[model samples]
Target: MKEMQGELATRALPDLVRDLHAAEATGTLEIEMQGQRRKLHFVRGEIYLPAATPLARRLAALLAEEHSDGHELTALVQRMVDLTSSWREGSYRFLESKDDSGGELVGPLPTLEFARLGGASTSPEAAEAPTESRPSAPPGPPATDPLAKLGGERARWITVPKRSGSFDPAEQWVLEQLRQPRTLRDLLEDSPVPRAELLETAAKLAAAGYLRSLDRPRVETGAFEFQSETLQRLRLRIASFLEEKPLDGDLESQRSRVMELLATREDLDHYQLLGIGPFASTDEVQRAYEEMARLVHPLRAEELGLAESAGALTELFDSMTTAYLTLSDNERRRDYDRQHGLGPEAATVTETSPTAARQEEREELARSYFERAMAYEARAEIHFAIEMLTLATATDPTHAEYFLNLGRLQARNPNWLRRAATSYLRGISLSPREIPPRLELARILEKLGELPRARVQYHTILRIDSTHQVALARRQELEERIAAENRGEGGLLGRFFRKG
Candidate 1:
């Protein structure tokens, strides 16, 4: 074959360049434009293609053009750059080639293999052995936004990035798909990998701790149990509060009833919560407040690090304070009683006296009309207050302070427990559905040793709110009492007096 070279041969040189490169032919190559020619030299593995125009020649030419300096070379080079970019994408033949004879022939030589022109031996083994190319994966189902497919329940999955290691790719895929509660089966359905093989691989990965365990998240029984324990503690506090006050013979029993009512519930009404029957003295109310406050006060919870229990602490404090406050005020108590129909009017006082004796009694009553009043004048019912103050004065007349206050104020002070118990009982009478008074009556009943009444109250409270504080506390106290008895704290008398 004749190899072409030089100006006449330059026209045919473009097509034969591929053949020369593949064949590893070495020689100088040249081309001409208009009447001028440029030579590019090649020696062994080295190539030298020199610039025909000076650097910055066109940029300078543009500046000169503004000044009307005529220079066509810059435009020509720019045209060549643009042409090269376009021709490379299309088919372009090497227009020069050289033979060992170094002849300047102009005719066309044979066509060259474009594919092998830039081929560098990848491996000696590849050259020796012809291996079959593996079939490529079918293009993935038209690319779609992965995020758009996640729907609403998307927080469950987390994105993980590519990493190193042989198992990394498989790990990443599993992690990406492992939404909580979504089993391996669901994950496999969405994956591109074959199910059987993927499952086998997934199992292996799980065994190696590279995949999540198949076990479902366990319910936290501890938290539920903790709540139950807290309720029990509240009941004990209520019990302790009542024990400090010795109520009227049956009042203790009534207080027990209230404790019983509150035993099983977490939230309790204030009036019924103490379990004291209506008409508790101010002293008893104060005592109950103190006892409960001691147990449930937010300040007390500092030891438990309750500061972290932001919500629970606030709720507990509010509930305890509210219960105490509601049962402590007389007017509120009376209103509550009136609403429940537990007014003192409901209790009938029997009279047994003849007309002459009754006439004498009226004469004496007229002389001391202030002896039995039920209203405080300072609070808008002077006559009622005077009547109560009169009686109080008669009882403790030696105290000048008592007499003056009674005469002036109509001392109609009601006992805290009495008012609370009255209110609670009224609540029960009015709304048998309500739980607080029932719980309170139960506690008071328990304190008075009326176990049956207390039990009924506790049962009722539980029926309404299973987690009543007094009820739970009483249960815990009873359990502890039992344990103490086992340890001989109550002794022989305790056993003998034990309720069946």
Candidate 2:
């Protein structure tokens, strides 16, 4: 194809880009303005390389100084697009080429997102406010605003742009809710946040191409009218929120419960722990961390009189904090994903540290032994089962499951209760989030007539899982029993003093 050349005086850059995108053209776009030249490579209409010039190098250096990774590249592209948009005297040419080497940046650059970025780049104040533009009411027979147009229909997510730094909590919440199509009215009813804030967030999201209205023309004038069904749903939600009572059990039980849960589950990586997918924006990670911290922090535990479980809560909080720190840093997040086989080049990459390899090997051996132990237990060979479980624990002391099983087997004999408790403690130390080992230990302590210790364990379990039926029942029963015993002792002392 012949190279297309033009002057910016006659043709606007945004119009040129739109034309190319509409045509699905693939090639390099070269722009020269104010004695500076930049090359942007396009692959089938998507922006593959926004800047292939000395400017990109300077941007890279700046990003390095700030300890950022992919965000700098995105910022540079946005800057270039913004600059090109305003150029009144510049020469532009599109060179038709089959070269598809540039793959670092992956964005189709939706028209809406491009427009928003342009607006953001131009006005500093606009960029600071997430919701600045309101869609003009479409002119027709019946007047219809953006919200009116989206009245009965749900908004489905198309794509979400990666964001850096802190995000508005309301915006983040709205984005999460938009993972699936939800109507504006539904969101208003569901979210405890202000209706105005939610509407603003939804409007911004729709404008950014992150959301698309399912139906264009649907309106109910009295949509907010109180209906019986809607009232019932709202009531249920309110009740659930208000029903969250404080931990009623003791601290030790809560710790055991958490440990037991940790033992049965497969180990979760940082991304999984934060409840986010790979390449999630730093803002998303921080929001997730903060939400989790509110539920699992030691301060929350202490408030509920579960202070004895503080050590367990602290370990969990530390791990979560580490995950947040690693994921918030661009370079560190990339390296972590790469190491965990979730990176873009993970399929082709075969990199492993010596320590990691050894750990994996030991875990495999421990699993094999654990399986054998389970088989022996199934056959009713208690001695052989214990021996195999011991091997598993010795092979991979870090494996919570191994220690949990060993503890359970040892607890079968009353004479070995202390040893079983010790084993459970080890498992808890390795995996603070596991709950089964901790639960078993609490039961063992109770059986050994250690009421105070058992009470702590029960409270700890409730701290981790408030709706745990066993923990709730045991804790309540223990409290009643302790109260009755105290009352009986007081009566006996009173009678004895009166006789004297």
Top lDDT: which candidate number?
2
lDDT of 2 by residue, 385-407 (tens): 77667656644555677878898
Per-candidate Cα lDDT values, in order, are 0.40, 0.57
Write one digit per residue (lDDT tens) for candidate 1, span 143-170.
2323212321121222111212465666
State the weakest 10-residue window (summed lDDT) of model 2: 134-143
Best by TM-score: 2
Regions of candidate 1 where Cα sits further than 4 Å from its true position: 1-267, 302-310, 341-500
Give the C-alpha lDDT of model 1.
0.40
Least lDDT summed over 10 consecutive residues: which range in candidate 1? 83-92
